[model samples]
Target: MPSLRSIRSRIRSVKNTRQITKAMEMVASAKMRKAQQRVLDTRPYAEKIYELMHRIASREKAWSSPFFETRPVQTIGVLLVSTDRGLCGAINANLFRSLVRFMKERPGVRFEFVTIGRKGRDFIRRSGFNLTGVIQGVKDRGTIEEILPATQLVIEEFSEKKNWQEAWIFYTQFESIMSQKPRHEKLLPIDPEVLTGSGNPPNGHSGEYLYEPDRRDILDVLIPRYFETVIFQRVLENFASEYSARMVAMKNATANAKEVIYGLTLTYNKLRQANITKEISEISSGAEAISQG
Candidate 1:
């Protein structure tokens, strides 16, 4: 048991905490709606561009884009995408765990990382990973200027033959508000099947596709667009995932705060009741004394 004053203070403190959590919950909810819409809207464009690119590649037998060819794995590039801020649930932790596992799986594979956010960059730097490139301050929505540089950096690295065989991007794919799956995808060497929809055994093609121009010429332009579209899609998914995680985190915090308030209210009631009991006892004793006197 504690004094009334102490219990009052505890209740007041919890009240303030509850207010803050409630505000955060509202903000996260609002942001989640916007992010979810953005992810849904951008997906179709990215998919269409990829499909067109595949159709072109599938039509050409001798397309010689560096992006289409595979090479020996001398060096690996890891592009890690994470939120710039914290207060999200286990989003970053899950991404980090997957990253660590990826590293462990390729012990002898020399790797360089391209980090997208401050969180991932800081983590890579602190862990002393060979971080080759970092792009920070990417907006929540997809922006061409913001992503173009990073895409170009990787494309140039491949075109220049920096001894990098493959590039992988790690991101949280937005499945639903309650579910986000950490995904590791090969970004380069654009899977011909992903483009042509042939790689998927279940695609069951209707017929051979038609081409607007020479398939090789179309591929020359489409490969870079493919990279851009993939990056844009990733940015959208990351935003949706961040908002979903934040919303869930704030909701939990709000619930915990409410529980704390309930406990404090119980304690406050008990302390006030004890005070009333003591005061009643004192008054009754005084009345008895007066009567006796």
Candidate 2:
């Protein structure tokens, strides 16, 4: 058994750790609330844009946008979004695991990756994947400009640079404080059903939307904005998921530290009482002996 003094020191250490975890928990909670709100506020607009893009995509050759051009997917672009730091429970680990599964599912398919955080960049490097672009230090509330590099990489791959035929983005989606879902969302060569959250088209000829000037004109204007909206919403969703995971992780840590402190304090108290009782017993014995003498 450890000495009482040593146990006291351990109790103090655990208390300090608990304090730190408690503070971090509070910070993560605050950030999670803001991030969740941003996601909720922007998701509808992003979804509508997604639905509109898919609707236009149904026009096929009738629509003149290069983004609508379909080709054999010789190369695929992947935009992997993850947090720069850890302490977020299994959030990043689960994402990385899913990414591995995605890669495994497409054995021969060459991938060009654009990473939006330090963790993703590291994974790309370690996994020996081609790193097309990297976006680091993005805030919880990232602006369109800040996320342009990533979206641009996807556009460049399929259009400007013309290296890849299709693109997808992977990120954890915030469902609730306790549930963050990792999603693999196709970004380009638009999957109509996926875009609109519909499992399948109702018929061979899907319903259409009317345009003011023409389909070409509207798509030309909306295509770039669609890219921006998709990327922005992904980033917001990523932020919210990251913060929620972190808050929950920190809360669990604080709770665990508290349990450790309680156990240590209990041990310390028991040992101290034993030592005090031993000293009193020894002193009393000595007094009785002295009186007898």
Best by lDDT: 2
Local distance difference test, candidate 2: 0.85
Best by TM-score: 2
| lDDT by residue (tens digit), candidate 1, 8-84 | 88888878987887898788789889989988988998878766655545555365667766677778888898889
Q: Candidates' lDDT values, in order?
A: 0.81, 0.85
Superposed Cα deviation of residue 45, candidate 1 (Å)? 2.3
Candidate 2, after superposition: displacement of residue 223 in Å?
0.8
Poorest lDDT segment (10 consecutive residues) of candidate 1: 194-203
Residue 159, model 1: Cα distance from true site in angstroms: 1.9
